[model samples]
Target: MAVLTTTVLRLEKSRRTTKKLKDNVVAYGFLAGGLICFGLFSWYPAFRALVLAFQQTNSVDEPTWVGLENFRLLFGDPEFVAAWRNTFYFTGLALVIGFLVPFALAVLLNELRHAKAFFRLAVYLPVMIPPVVTALLWKWFYDPGPGLFNEVLRFLHLPTSDWTNSTNTALISLVLVATWANLGGTVLIYLAALQGIPGELYEAAELDGASVWQRIRHVTIPQTRFVMLMLLLLQIVATMQVFTEPYIMTGGGPEDATITVLYLIYKYAFVYLDYGSACALSAMLLAFLGVFSALYLRLTREAT
Candidate 1:
């Protein structure tokens, strides 16, 4: 009886081991497929760009190595400086306006007990529209004479300003369009994070005589600090690479007030037909973003 029992146990253990191995094999197969796709679509292009950054190539001729020349040219170009300045400025303004607005909207939506679904849908509707279409729609609204905004201003007997045609306001105008189009996703993210907070914390704060602002500062902000930090980093990165709005709306016009690094890259590659310089500019942006990401992760990890 003891021998029979031992044989049965051994058979069961072997079967379980085989099943586990088979499951792992299947999981790893799926993972390998994803990795292969990423390699072909993402990693390969990045590697090619890096290599091309140091080599002069027009895709038809044999490439010649020219280390640092492309970068030197970029540094000497006045447009490069302008592009970086505009990018940094846009990022700062976005942090000031775009960053806070979504959070505020999310909080307000959270507080609403009535028509919650309808409001969320409205907030997120812009996000569902394609970015190109959003740019076109806002472009029409920004038209100087018959634009929707100018018409409304005229109706109110208020002065009409050139929204995208003036150097002073062109960047900010693009920023507004960007904020409205991109904020929906951020609001929804913040809403989800808000919903995950413990209700008990809010109750405790209320019991302690905390006002609405105090509760938000003490309880809500602290609870969502991680999400906020991550979004801040993402927002900075995204704004720095802003291209679509400036590309379609301003065309980097009003004396290049709206030119950004990515738009510059597009000009280099497509308009100027300087693939090497374009790749070099892309490399610079990549390096900056990479360092920023690493530093951010390191700091956040230490904080956590």
Candidate 2:
């Protein structure tokens, strides 16, 4: 009996040691691989972009040092300024509408019981389509006369604007398409978050005579504040890079209204072969995003 007990103890010890060895191997392997990959693909390329921002090149051998000339030129150029304005406009619109709409939709979806899963799937279905495909589909829908959008408006005796070609409506039309593609994923995420909230919290609020607005304001909003902030920051950064829609749909017209920072960089590097200026523009956008991320982190830290 004593021998059997000793044998069992020894086996348990052996198993523990084996587990520790396996864990160590996995942890070290992950750390080493992560560091190597980050250094090779992310860190090195980031520093290289900073270097390229200060140097002049056309994708050939050793770029010449140009000091801050690229940045100077980027700032002084009227087209660059217009792109910057467009970028901010898109960012603001996306941040305001994108985050809020998804949150509101998610809350409404949470109230749904029958076909809840179906509704969730429906909300996220559009995001499954590729952005370029979504852009193309929206472009067809915006066609002046025969497009479904215009046809619907005409059927309703409402005015049908020439969406993508009209200087007045082109940007808004592109925004609507982008929103349709993006809204799904945001809604899904928000739905998950809302469902995670305890029913007890709502019940408690109700017991306290809290109105719907008060419950949302004091409970829902507070509960989801971190997620909301993070998504807002991500949307702002992502929207500032609006490119594919305008590229494939409007070609940065009517009158350059939709030319964004990323579109400008594409024109600089590919069309004009101005590698240095493209890198410089990329660097500026990177700086803005970095500042935004840092500020968001700081705000979240303070809140916590």
Candidate 3:
């Protein structure tokens, strides 16, 4: 009887092992295609970019290794410092003008009891428009003479000023256009975060005799702090990579006032035909952003 029981137990264990192996094989089969696609498309290109950063290529011959020469040339360029300065300036201006506006609009929109969907759609309509179209449209609006903005200023008896034509306002003009075009997406994201907040918190705040601002300061801000922080990082990154507005609208003109890092990168690759320098700059930008991301993650983790 003991020998028979041992034989049955062995049979059961073997069956279970076979079932587990089959299940693992099936799971791997499902994952294989996506893994291959990511390796081929994403990982391979990233690795190639890293390799290319140290090499010189003209797209007609074999790439020659230049070590740090490309980086040295990039650092020596006059526009390098200006590009970074302008990029930081744009980022700061964007934070000042763009960041808080969306959150404020979101909070206001959240309080609205009627036509909420219509208001949301109206705000987001600009974001759906093509960037090129937005640039062209805003370029016309910024025209020094007879432009929409100037006309409005004229009607209001205010002094007309050069919008994009002057070095003084070129960067700010680009920022305004950028803020208008991009505000919708952030507003929607903030609105979504606001909606996720529990109503009971707001009720408790009101019961404590908190005013609107007090409720927002204590309840709303705390509840959406994570989303706000994440969006702030994203906005900083986006503003740092700004190229299209300055490219299409100002052409980095008005004494290079609107020249940004990405715009400089574009000029290196296309205008100067210096792909190596462009790649080197790209690698540097990637490293900086990587550090920023790591720091942000560490800070957020510690806070939590």
Over the stretch 97-183, how does candidate 1's per-residue lDDT look in tens digits? Answer: 999999999999999999999999999999999999999999999999899999999999999999999999999999999999998
lDDT of 2 at 87: 81
Candidate 3: C-alpha RMSD to true structure equals 2.2
Off by over 4 Å in 1: 1-12
Best by TM-score: 1
Distance from true location, Cα of 56 in model 1, Å: 0.5
Candidate 1 displacement at residue 216 in angstroms: 1.0
Question: How big is the positional error of residue 61 in model 3, measured in Å on the Cα after superposition?
Answer: 3.5
User: How would you order the candidates by lDDT, starting with the best?
Assistant: 1, 3, 2
Candidate 2 local lDDT, 1-304, one digit each (tens)? 9999999999999999999999999999989988999899999988888898999889666799999999998988888988998888877777667778889998899888799889888989999998889988999899997999999999999998899998788888888888889998898888777878899999999999999999999998888877787787788878988999989999888898888899999998899888889999999999988998898789788554
Structural similarity to truth (TM-score) of each candidate: 0.95, 0.88, 0.91
Each prediction's whole-model lDDT (CA):
0.95, 0.88, 0.92
For model 1, name the residue pairs that clash.
none
Mind giving the per-residue lDDT tens digits that candidate 3 earns over 1-304?
A: 9999999999999999999999999999999999999999989987787887899976577889999989989889889998999999999999999999999999999999999999999999999999999999999999999899999999999999899999899999999999999999999999999999999999998999999999999999988998898999999889999999999999888788999999999998899877888888888998998899889888897444
